[model samples]
Target: MKRVVITSVGAVTPVGLDAESMWQNVKQGKHGFAPISSFDTSRLKVKNAAEIRNWDPVAMGLNKKEARRMDRYTQFAMAAAKQLIDSAGDLSGIDPYRAGVIVGSGIGGFQSTVTEHAKFLEKGPDRVSVFLIPMMICNMAAGQIAIEYKFRGDNFAPVTACATSAHAIGEAFRKIKDGYLDLCITGGSEGSINEFAVAGFQNMGALTESQDCDRLCIPFDKERSGFVMSEGAGLLLLEEYEHAKARGAQILGEIVGYGATDDAHHITGPDPEGDGAAHAMLHAIREAGIEPGEVGYINAHGTSTPLNEQCETAAIKRAFGEHAYKLAVSSTKSVTGHMLGAAGGVEAIITMKALEEGVLPPTVGYKVPDELCDLDYVTEGARKTEIKYALSNSLGFGGHNASLLLKKFEG
Candidate 1:
């Protein structure tokens, strides 16, 4: 099989606006979740969120008019794409036909969609802005990035709920490996923390009932309850290994394996036995031709939701046996909150950072770890260690599960 590598990464997360800022906050065990300020939350049951606070996309070099027409989610993606391209240098040197984009969103511009719909209802059919459809469509995230960067290759925007970004990245990996594209920009974005989204999560009991500052978003903790609504975007520049080497591109990590599965049991709940989740992890391990023991750490899909934490624990144990107890597991979500579809991509960056920096982030707010999740979670604090390989799992609503394996770049 052809080799694929991640050349550059960028992020717009609750912790910060770029990958370096997010990683620094992650290392310090910072919590981005706070009472919602983007919108009035006086009456909402879940009032706290990990918002991309006071973000001005103009810092990413986009003009006001252009950025204004874009919905917040798309704006975030565009900003992140700018960071990615800036870090990767001028892609103009490469063939435009050989470059492509694959980005996704679980819920595309919920705030924009709901706002425009309200306008139409409050005034007349013509009250909705002309940019409504363009700004609200999920594909626009990928489309806008491709247009800005002059990438004329394949562009896709998968919508698999939370699994959206994971599938997008995984599929892009296959494309590069199969020789369909030489360079691909891929990742996920989300900006759905509006009234409707918060209400929906609250009605479904997905957000924590408690407003306690320290108790919120405690993933894999004995008192863990539900996820905190969050917003952000993560983008990765991936290239064929030979193409990267020929160009002297910096390699962050190699994509060794990817696996996706469905619970086939419920739309919102994971299989209690972790059947589907385990299959995803095991499939990744088997595809990489590596033993479970080879994995040194896991960027867990530990969403801080009760069922997901428990089921993921079962899945890890089933997939790795004794190795499960030895591996360092940490949830970046514990600090960044849950970026939904973008979780996979952001966590992928975290895994690569861990490998490169030799520093493992601790799962903050893990005062009392759940008995079911008995593992060396690196919870005491950030620890310096050599991580040969790492796994990042992303499970979304609708029974979607995805796992990706990233190895420390040796070339």
Candidate 2:
């Protein structure tokens, strides 16, 4: 199998408009969350989110005319994709057919769907815009990305709930490893912060109803209530190892192994014992040919929700045993809030960056640790250490569990 390397990465997250800006803010533990501004959440229990602020579409290089048509999710994806494409400059030398784009989203164009549905009811079906279906479908992100970059090899979307991006990226790794394509842009995006989503999560008791927006997303804390809804997008340029070396592309990191599994247990909740998640960890480690002890840091799937944090902790203990206690595991969600489908993409970047910089990001808001979740969550701020191997985990609805193992580039 040919080796796959991540040459470049870009992000348009609530924390920042681009990767550099986002990383700087997140590293400083600066919270981007505040009272929701897109809608009047005056009557709602949770009125805050990690909403992207001060982001004018034109600021991201999008014209007002073009920005008017795209929904928030597409805008974020486009911004991230543009940055990644810029990083992989002068792709004209490579055949467009050898390039691909695979973006994922659990919910796509949600705002578009709701708006068009209202229009259909108020006006007529004919009043719906021609771009309604094409724009609102979950696969449209991938289609739009391919069209923007003229990538012709592979274009598709992965929708596995929050595991959506992990699966997309993992599949991209396989495509490159099998020599299917020389370069591929893969990641995920989501923009589902709406009244409907809030009502649903609130009814199901899966949302943080705290009035303090700044401290609502307290992942892994003993008093952690629920996940703070957020929106964002992340894109990564993946290329074959020799192809990247030949072009002297900056290798961001090497994706060594990927593993995915389904629990067949529940639709909304993870298995209490974390059987599915543990299996994913085992599979990824085996594929990487490494012992449990080799993994120095883990970007955990800690969503600040009670079930996920507890269950994921159980899974980690089951998979790594004593090594789990020795490793540094932190949930970037604690700092960035929950991005739903885009969660995996941001966490993947976090893991790769930790490997690159040898600094583990702290999981903020960890006031009182739970007994069942006994692990060193790197809470004493960023720690500088040798991170030879890093693992990123994501568990989503439908019992989806995805794990990706990354290592420092050697030889």
Candidate 3:
């Protein structure tokens, strides 16, 4: 089997428009949360969200005509893909058949659906957009990315709720590792910060109604509420180890292991005992041929929800034993406000940066820790430490769990 490495990465987060800027802001403990500005939230119980302010697609280099046809989610995906391709340099020598795209979106074109349905209700069925179906489907992000780059190889999107992007990256890694593809664009994007989405989550008691930015999205804290809905995109350019070396590509990190599992216990909650999540982490560590103690950091799927943090902590302890306390663990969601489908992709990039820079990002807004969550959450600030292997976990609503093991590039 061939090895796979991440060559380039791009991010469109609430805090920064690019991966480096986002990393720097995260290292500085800057959060992107604020009162929602995309729409008037007078009717919403949830007041604030981590929104990408001043988002202008045309300014990002997309033509107006192209932007008009896409949902906001697809626009973010295209922008991230452009950044990834630009950073990856010339890939002209790669066969189109050996290149692929696997970008997923948990809630696709939500704004479009709400807008078009309202139009249909008021203006008649004839007023509905012909492009509505193409724009709102969850798979359009992957399709549009493949179309943009002319990739002819395996192209599809995995829709595993919050774990969508992690599954996408894991599947892409396997394709390259098994020699099915030489290169792939993989990650997830989300642009569902609309009133309908917010209302849905809030009504379900899955979103924080906090008006205070500092108190919002406090993962692993005793006062932690539900997640704050956010929007963004994160994409990674992955290539076979030999293929990347042949092209003289700058290898950012190596994906050594991936483990995916399901709880089969709840539709919207993780297993109370975190059995599925624990097994997923163990599987990933075993696949990497590394002991539990070797993992120095974990970008946990700590969603700031009471049940999730407790369960994730249990899973970490179950998987790592005493090592769980020794290793550092933090949640970037406290800064990004839960990007939903994009969370995994964004957190994966953060984990890679932490491994490469030897700086573990802090779980900002963390205070009043819960006794259930006893792990060493780097809460005070970003901590600098040297480490080899790390894990990024993404647990989705359908009990879907994915763990990715990344190693700093030694060669």
| Top model number, TM-score | 3
Tens-digit lDDT string for candidate 1 (346-404): 88889889998888998988888678878877788899999888989999888999999
Residue 288, candidate 1: how far off, in angstroms?
1.7
lDDT (10s digit) by residue, model 3, range 1-411: 898899999999998899999999999889999999989999989989999899999988778998999999999999988889999977989999999999999988898999999999999999999999999999998998898889999999999999999999999999999999999999999999998889999998899887789989899999988998888999999899999999999999999999999999988988999999999999989988889999999999999898999999999989998888999999999888799999899999999999999999999988796889998999989998999999999999999999999999998
The best-first sequence of candidates by lDDT reads 3, 1, 2
Off by over 4 Å in 2: none
Q: Which candidate is the best by lDDT?
A: 3
lDDT of 2 by residue, 1-411 (tens): 889888899898888878877776666677677888888887688888888876677788776887677877888888888889888756778888989888999889988888888899999999897778777888887887888879999899999999999989999998988889999999899988988788788889988998786568877788888988889898888899999988888888899889899988999999998889988988988988889899998899988888898999989988988888899888888778889988888788878888888888888877887887888888787788987998999988889999999998775
TM-score of each: 0.98, 0.97, 0.99
Answer with 2 or 3, whichever has the higher TM-score.
3
Candidate 1 lDDT (Cα, 0 to 1): 0.88
Backbone clashes in model 2, listed as residue pairs: none
Q: Clashing residue pairs, candidate 3?
A: none
Query: Once model 2 is optimally superposed onto the true structure by TM-score, how far is the C-alpha of residue 288 displaced, in angstroms?
Result: 1.4
Model 3, position 29, has a per-residue lDDT of 87
Report lDDT per candidate: 0.88, 0.86, 0.93
lDDT over C-alpha atoms for residue 61 of model 3: 75
**How many steric overlaps are in each model, in order?**
0, 0, 0
